[model samples]
Target chain A: MTETSISLQDIVLHFPKQRNIFGIISDFFRKKIRRFTALSGVNLHIKQGEVVGIIGRNGSGKSTLLRVISGIYPPDEGMVHAAGDISLLAGLGTGFSPHQTGRENALLYGSILGHSEEEMLSKLDEIIEFSELGSFIDEPLRTYSAGMKARLGLAVASAIKPNILLIDEVLGVGDPNFREKSKNKILAMVKGASTVVIVSHSFGLMTDVCDRVVLLDRGKIIAEGDPQTSIKAYYDLEE
Target chain B: MGQNGPTTPVLRQIGVKSNPLLAPINTLKEVRSNRFLVRNLIRRDVRGRYRNAALGYAWTVIEPALLASVYWFLFIMLSGNPDEMYAVWVLLGVIVWGSFSKSLNAATNSLTGNVRTMHLVFFPRSIFPVSGVGANIVVTMMSCLIILPLLYIYELPITIHLVWIPIGVLLAGFMALGFGMMMAPLNCVQRDVQHLIRFITRAGFFVSPVMWTAEMAMERGAWGEAALWNPMVLPITMVRHALEGKSVELPDSIVISSLVVSFLIYVVGTMIFSKYERGAVKYL
Candidate 1:
């Protein structure tokens, strides 16, 4: 029996071009909307426990594909099938409020991720320790540096053991030491049975972590194979 | 884990279910699953409102108290003591209206306000309006505490009928939630809906029985009879009747119609909300 953790068949996603408030008001009378296709007729499948790295240039639909797979954006066409609870580490500090302390933000983020308060509280010490914020954990998030915020975000997100994890550009932030620490933490997470899909621009990081690499360009998969071959093809495409 | 090992079920179903009939059931299931998320959102909303204030949660009570006083002065001066306990009546009406207005206002902006988090997380979208209702309910309960002292001071008789006050508040909440669920998604699509609801709610304050009693409307005959059609009329009147221990005659037809309308609004609102909820993030 083949175990497929994630599958997408002919997936298509189109985002209606956003309009300014005034434009929206005028369009209310005009009733016209323009759409931009983010992904079109893309298909992929990942086996259980496979680490797939998605690499693409900016506006190449890398993050959009991750979102579609995570069930954030419903595909305009096609089907997405996945087995297991999925966690998305999209942008840093998506759930954190500037006015809230790091401790409060952790609990809030945990709650948003479907963990109960008691459950989060029980894991509070571990999350704080992993974030390495120390006394700053009690301070409001507005005062934290970008690196500090990224560390906290990654720590809280990885603390929960998801069945499938979708990561997007989160590993590229923070200092070298913390980046290495975060990279190891992610490696440890994927070392388990969890299927992972990471989107990044850094070829070194992608080759370091991914067992397989899928290259996307303008909403289409341009290449797929072992990390070295795909990374080579991606660099070749740049020329 | 092996190829056939049991794993956690899929985190989300990719497409929106096509069956309209099942939308409400799916929404209910989503709510039940995200109950903890809803609770924390309510806490965050209520706490976040007064986070940096010196007075803190005291502002919750102070707001209604201040509103009640203003209404008390204006109405008492205008009518010159139509009823001996008119002050209590106005206070009750104001508090009940407070809950409805607060819920409606909060739920209207709930989705638009949380577009950032909505884009990041994949929980049921209904959590926003539900949490909005939850937050306002907390504020209403806190304000209701003032009634205890007022009850003692006024020497208002506590009959079994007073039990209906909570039921009345709950009904008001349902009405607000229904209206809110209807408007929240629409507001996401159009900024106009937000301004429109604000206007309606402001006008609604005068149109509802917040400042005057049903008896005053009845004194005007046809206008009084027509005011019975407003959804807020029954709940406000019921609360006043419950608190004052007055034997106010509520027509059976009006009571039944009000309840039916509230239920319809709730059912229809949920259906409309479920339809638009999935697409809300797109517009946002």
Candidate 2:
């Protein structure tokens, strides 16, 4: 009954078959190079303020679908219409440079996410606080561990609340304590009425947060229902 | 954060379109909206280059000056002209041609160089190349300052024609951006494209009017006409004309033709870039 916040109609995305220089040169004279279809004829609609979970095996178009909705990967066919600001929390620390300090990379990452530098500056303290990096924020990003880098990325991206937030398998990052903190943060965001989409292999978080779940297998949505039903469907696919 | 009161959802529509004419206008709009990102990127590029070097920013000025001296020495050895004016002339040529060549090469590598950011977030993919052009323009204008000391040393009188220096620099940028927009996408599609760009720019340094004035080439008759085939001839010559404070002896036909070619390249480049950019990611 609620207004649809994001709509996808028969979306399809494909990537050219990888080729070496010799292969490409040969293909130039020969015929067409093959393409690997990542997503094919997928259709779905998400309502405003609803939490949706997408679960799929590796290379089943889970991340690719998220990219499509975020406008990173333009669909080869069909259309994507989203009614609000959308931010995808994949590849955390998007524009980060190892040579730059943690604080500087935070600003750069935030700017890449469409926030102005001044706005990021204002939130720099909050980001540092949430990241718990202490004085290490001034140290170059190369000094940080994988978990530290993930923490810094999450801290900056979550600083600005988006109307629609899509998080990808990033909740498993950082220490167990930080992982719990991030889960609480996402739950808070959902409670705040932000339309949220999550893609994760784990269904425990989905059972706790998602109103409905969509199961994807080899590019198509195979089932959609309550979280319990979709989880059963996913397990059946695995078997 | 979702108060749900008086909310106007921002609509984003994504689909495929075949129109090329609209590419430029769309790019302009994207650039305007992301002006801050462009500015930040340009600043980062300029500052990042000198971050850890002991010489730091001095390298910006010293680099062209050093190249100028080498070329000046070589010209004297080859032509046996000990004229002080020759030193000044070589410096101006080196500065202009260096920036133009670097701009082209930089823009070509721009997209390939920023694959992480390009894939992680969606701004205009065009921003990378455009900022590459911007950073080069900034560096060229700054590097042009070396000309001041050269002029003072040679006691060359500054004239009204000196105004053409900035115009020439900007025109060089425009031309480079056109070529860059066309090449950046392809460079992503094929890694070899970047290597090819490097080779072309290197070879271009000799064939272009960098070492010799268009006037010198013009006196050679057929060689002059052949040299005119390079679009850089006019801008390079224009910068030299500004420094020497001489009338532009270039014929009207060549000037008009160069301008038209530059504009057409820019339009066509954007068209190709916009159409192929989304697909280029597949290769990346």
Candidate 3:
């Protein structure tokens, strides 16, 4: 039996339309709800250590697929499986508190990524050095520029080695130097005996990093296999 | 609790430890990740709120100090011959009850403001509310440190009864965290819940005895007398009584009942928060 690192068979996700203030207050009084699904039916299976990439236009269920696989959103319609622990780093730095210093946030963000205090402490110097945040590390992240924040976030996420790392367009962060560091870190992570599933629109990023690519359109898979073929097929479909 | 949740003989709450949609721990994990997050959050809240160069740490004490002065000006100075004991009562209630209500109110809004984090990662969502209380406690403590010196400067006698302050503060934290957490997932799905918290917390400001005396509350008949039966009222009263060097008078039943209420809130809040915290993220 080929070992599968993560599996999703006929998965579906739905989100309800948001409520305005009036609706929310009424909800408190009435307490009624009905959810809407975002993904109709999706099927995917990733083998161990596979660098599978998911590509699609906006709202094409690429994020939903990754979320379901990483166990963020449970599929209403199908079975999802992972052989071992699964860690998701979907949007780097999204989990950070804005008013906190980067150094302190490193511990909080690191914990969010499943690192214990000791592990976070041990890796603190390494994380700070890797991100090259320097003196700004002691300042609240609200003080950092967007790119600086992204670098800090990515650094924290990468510090914790997840068994099945899920990336969602995080490669397009920071300036040239920081982006290079992030890419190298990603490459190093991919080389480990762990699976990675990335969702990105950048054909170069997907082809350069992914072993194979799956194209998604309108919440369904349009093509799969070689990155070049998938890219060409996606472009053809778009045309 | 799952394999990743804490295994402490005692835990703060379930969702704070594990849930299938979030951290998904079952007790054995005993890893203190969320606690670490809470500590950082509390530290950051205290540090960031005070780090402004103009007033710096004095900012922590300023608001309460201003309120106290204004209150003293109106009630004591205007009336003439104000007792030190009454000032102590006002100080205690102002600090403790204000902190508790603020924590709960702010906690109800924690999940909303951090929607970016809420959408990207899953942990016991209860931690958001807990972080709010934790921050409140840190801020409250810093303010209290400043308040005590003011008491000494003002010539109010310090007593051993001051030791009870920590316990009183803890109970307040538990109460706010319990209620805030119960309302958190609901707030995430419903924005008006935040507004409702504002309305009610303001109402709480008047009813919570923060600015009033327990003797006054007792004089109001069934509703007021009936409330010393309510757990929060007794504690608020106790804080005032303790600060004034009065005997710590609390009915055993009230203590037990308040603890029970706090526990129930923690239980129900965890169950409800876990049921919906993951699902609520999509709405955000």
As for DockQ, the candidate ahead, 2 or 3, is 2
Identify the leading candidate in terms of DockQ: 2
Docking class of 3: acceptable
The 10-residue segment with the lowest total lDDT in model 2 chain B:
B1-10
Model 2's CAPRI class is medium
Off by over 4 Å in 2: A18-33, A135-145, B1-4, B8-12, B16-18, B158-161, B245-249
lDDT tens per residue, model 2, A1-239: 27788899999998887545576667777887667899999999998878999998999999999999988898989899987677788888776777788987888778788887677888999999999999999998888999999999989988877778888887777899999998787678666646889999889989998999999999999999999999999999999
- In order, the Cα lDDT scores of the candidates are 0.81, 0.83, 0.71
**Residue-wise C-alpha lDDT for candidate 2, range B198-265, written one tens digit per residue:** 88988989998877877678779997778877888888888888877764558888898899999898
- Candidate 1 achieves a global lDDT of 0.81
Q: After superposition, how far is residue A235 of candidate 2 from its true place, in Å?
A: 1.8
Task: Report the C-alpha lDDT of model 3 over B85-146, residue by residue, as the tens digit.
Answer: 66655667777877888888877887787776666775655567777788888777777776
Best by lDDT: 2
In model 1, the fraction of reference contacts reproduced equals 0.44
Error of 1 at A139 (Å): 5.0
The residue-level lDDT of candidate 3 at B158 comes to: 85
lDDT (tens digit, per residue) of candidate 1 on A92-128: 6676767788998888778887676677888899999
Q: How well does candidate 1 match the true structure in TM-score terms?
A: 0.91
- Candidate 2 residue B252 Cα shift, in angstroms, is 2.6
Which 10 consecutive positions of candidate 1 chain B have the poorest summed lDDT? B1-10
